[model samples]
Target: MTTAPADATVRVRYFAGARAAAGIPEETIRLAAGATVRDLVAELGSRHGDGLTRVLTACSFLLDGISVRDHGITLVDGSGVDVLPPFAGG
Candidate 1:
């Protein structure tokens, strides 16, 4: 039988400037169960320091391929989040 996990495992993808600032294209973050997006974001900011925190401020997020408009949304185990910074073009 399958058992529930004690923590939520989030797969995070960073794009463009966000990726550059984070120095990694993607990563797996383990957060406490019932933790919200806000909590995850806060943890990231604290983990990566000021440069990433700045980039995160201007970036938009997609949770499991859907845009996340609410930071309070709770994260479940195996959630995938994308951090997309502004892209420059014509």
Candidate 2:
């Protein structure tokens, strides 16, 4: 298996509908060493165009399973950031 750099930037992974909506399986996002989760969102929004604003508003962010609402939350390299929306069904 190929290995990534130790200080390599973050990698964003979208699941289920998010992946389809984003139109990409995954992305290697380049962020500042101490970029915040909010920063990542903005970066992604830029990449996805204006549609991202609406989509992102409906989604919840998770850092390694911990729900994150504070935009100021600092992100480190190799961290997992999940963009999740509410699930519906009976």
**Number of the top TM-score candidate:** 1
25-67 in candidate 1: lDDT tens per residue?
9999999988988898888899888999999998889999999
C-alpha RMSD between model 1 and the true structure: 2.5
Candidate 2: misplaced stretches above 4 Å? 1-8
lDDT tens string, model 2, 19-75? 767888778887876678888988888888766556776788888778897879888
Clashing pairs in 1: none
> Residue 33 CA error for candidate 2 (Å)?
2.4
Whole-model lDDT per candidate:
0.92, 0.77
Please list the Cα RMSD from the true structure of every candidate, rounded to 1 decimal place: 2.5, 5.6
- TM-scores of all predicted structures: 0.91, 0.79
